[model samples]
Target: MRELITKYKPVIKFIVLFLGAYLLLSVAYGGYLKVSSHYGYTPDFITDLVANQSSWLINAAGYKAQVIPHDAKPQMKLIVDGNYLANIIEGCNAMSIIVLFIAFVIAFAQKLKKTVLFILGGSLLIYIVNIVRIAILAIALYKYPEHQSILHSVVFPGIIYGMVFLLWMLWIKMIKKSAT
Candidate 1:
């Protein structure tokens, strides 16, 4: 048992770090949600920010885009060109994705300064990409309502997750190069 543990120490360490970070961040987020709801921030600040940015981008693309609070839920209703397109929910905010990204990056962390910088930069990149993704998705939905299922379920998810995967790979390569 000791030999096996010694042999796989790095793997074990990675797993523990990843799970610990993920759980801690997720709990913090849940607390934020609870507090926001308690204080009357219906959609929460991050989700609202994402919705507003997405709407701004869609408007910049020549569409009359706007976001309004949902009447029955904690979400924003995205309207483009007077068409009811999609709902911007808390999940759409991408904080969860950022949390996942941060967890993975921390698992493979190199140095304190580099790790913190990467987390900050990577989180910002993910947030911006999510806003753009939401904008493009809204525009695509407005243009091709028929393909809504595929666009929402598969394609857009692939884009964001794919971007995170690429970032992870880049981080690994960067650390390896620095170590050498």
Candidate 2:
């Protein structure tokens, strides 16, 4: 057992660091949400952006869309043509991307000089993709309200995860090239 552990020490360290960082980020994010809710400091930027985009989506679909705040929670509920379609909660959609990035950073800790830029760029891309995802989801809900469940639960998650996978692949390619 000791011999085996010594042989794969690097791999074990990578896994431990990745898991620790990911867990810490998740906990911090959850705490942020809780405190933000309690103090009513949730950023107005997303809410306003969604509201404006909802109007456009509603007009395009010829259906009335309403985005209203939940009374008991710090979340936005999207109502489409008088029916509840989806709820936009803080840290709900981008949790995977955030966690995955933290994991990736930890996994690349030794190569920080080469990887930090990649990490930052990837994070920015993820953020932009998230906004696009939300917008596309809004449009999707407007176009095919009946398919909201699949789109919201499955398709969107796949998109974000797919993007994260692509980012990781890109990182690997870059690291390989650097080694060569």
User: For this target, which candidate reaches the highest TM-score against the unseen true structure?
Assistant: 1
Off by over 4 Å in 1: none
Residues 39-149 of candidate 2 have per-residue lDDT tens digits of 664333344454546445565656677777777766677777676766777555465576688577668664766666776778778866776777678778767988978
RMSD of each: 0.6, 3.5
Residue-level lDDT of model 1, residues 85-125, one tens digit each, is: 99999999999999999999999998899999999999999
Q: What value of lDDT does candidate 1 attain over all alpha carbons? A: 0.96
Candidate 1 least-lDDT 10 residues = 37-46
- The parts of candidate 2 lying over 4 Å away from their true place are 42-66, 79-84
TM-score of each: 0.99, 0.78
Q: List the residue pairs that clash in candidate 1.
A: none
Residue 65 local lDDT, model 1: 97
